[model samples]
Target: MGTLLSGRARAHPRELARFVRLFTVVRREIEYALRPTGDLLHRLALETEFSDFAFLQTVDTRFRQGEPLSDAWDAAVLALQTEKLLKTEEIALIQAFCSAFGSTDPAGQSANCAYFIDRLSELQKGAAEAAGKKSRLYLALGVLGGVFAVLILL
Candidate 1:
């Protein structure tokens, strides 16, 4: 899942927006009709069109197989980290989310999800800005290098 998204993100900077949308949907779904975490994950696994569908499915499966939600979420996040798909800030946000998730009442869990979603959205914006700046910097460097080469030739 992260594999596919990482590659796609390289080609389309808006890929992280998909992740934002995913979290928003999760928040909305849970808030609409609170259910058990495992059941919520199972439903998201079936309904989500995001690249993290596999991650959600794996967590749901592991939870059903007797793993704790935090443990399953940790394992899944670790797998995503190994793929290098997440930034350091994003990783910290996700870890915080896992720690708080399932340890609270349904309302609290929903609020936790909302908090993380907002944090993730902010990180996404920063990343997009950084990517844009780096692209412009690289473009300027390329142009400068071309001009220098032409001057040297003359």
Candidate 2:
């Protein structure tokens, strides 16, 4: 179980990086595509390498309903749960980034987007580093533990 979670933990940062890309895209598009958010969402959905494409469509619908972008993202947290690759901190960062669109000023929103992108990027980098260092260690430990257990039983 520890090994499984360790692997997933490493992978989770990449998932966070996906969200970072999404946030950066929105930041870049803020001037031309901020409003009529469905259009923005569609564009981002197509352009992004993110696998959770449905979440963007759902966010579009929420935007159409005039929900705040933050709330829309909050609504989509359920979708994140489905990915199974995200940690709670990652989810919280995404939730916090959802507010980037709350500002009417494109520059301000873009700044917010940049902040999220940077933060998520840093987080993903940290996770990737930990994964590279720890995954092998944990796998070895698990094998040794199993060997010890078998020897004790014998």
Candidate 3:
């Protein structure tokens, strides 16, 4: 819904926030349950409807393989790099979100997730504004180009 309308691979603020909230909740659950990282990831995997389910699976596999959390996070972000549906800013935000899950400390991870949530909210507003203006400009340019070409042919 967001990428198509925005004419780029940008996530809607609301959609971005929804994932941020999921991360926050997961962070809290980790802190309270004192669970192993892989166990948590497996749990998340079972809840596979998230847009980033594949990413979560990657993280889970990385954890199971004894890879560093940061490494796992990087792998997930790397997968996102080639997606045409994501703008550079959206990728940057995703990188930031992944970084939060890298923290070994639950409190620290939760804090980072919260901070990025606020940042993404602001970005969403800016994306909406840019999309409206850019769409109009593109439309006007297209019409003008079409009319000029017809006149030249006449």
Candidate 4:
């Protein structure tokens, strides 16, 4: 009976590991799907604008019905869908990952998901800062050139 109980306990961990694996794949898919691209950002902005409109509509409805909070779920879902658009190749990659390791533990999966999300956010922030610096440098150079030209004329 002790041996049987030990086997059962081991099985639980194994099962949990499998669920975690599934969660990891799903999280990775979500990240890849939401990766920023020039075209993707443009589309996302449009979708965000639409989402705002939908949110307003929901809020208006809620106000009329004397509800405190709006029915914002639909708008949020729409926005999420828009931002999480996946390309064919990304979708295939995610599907393959899921097929191979779909049984990961939930706790492990959540940890992995959070790690990836944080990493992605950090990368995005770095990229944005770099872009902002470049823009500022270019603007300063343009202003200096304009001043130089005026001095030469004078």
Q: Tell me the whole-model lDDT of each prediction, alpha carbons only.
A: 0.70, 0.73, 0.65, 0.41
Query: Which numbered prediction scores highest in TM-score against the true structure?
Result: 1
Error of 3 at 32 (Å): 3.8
Question: lDDT tens string, model 1, 1-154?
Answer: 3333333445323545655676687677777877766777777777747535555666777888999888888887787677675676677776777787667876787788888878778877877776666666666666777788899999
lDDT of 3 by residue, 1-154 (tens): 2224445423444445455566666767766786766676667766745535666777777867898776877887687675444467876887776655645577776677677767766776776676667666666776777788899999
| Window of ten residues with lowest summed lDDT in model 1 | 4-13
After TM-score superposition, the amount by which residue 135's alpha carbon in candidate 4 deviates from its true location, in angstroms, is 2.6
The per-candidate count of clashes, in order, stands at 0, 0, 3, 10
Model 4 segments beyond 4 Å from truth? 1-108, 151-154
Better of 3 and 4 by TM-score: 3
Scored against the true structure, residue 111 in model 3 reaches a CA lDDT of 75
As for model 4, its CA RMSD to the true structure in angstroms is: 21.6
**Where is the poorest 10-residue window by lDDT in model 4?**
36-45
Candidates 1 and 3: which is better by TM-score? 1
Estimated TM-score for each candidate: 0.71, 0.70, 0.60, 0.30
Residues 1-154, candidate 2: write the lDDT tens digits. 5598567657766676667778777776786666654567756666546445666767767877998766777788878877767778777877776554654578788788788888889888898888877777777878888899999999
> In lDDT terms, how accurate is model 4?
0.41
**Candidate numbers, best TM-score first, in rank order:** 1, 2, 3, 4
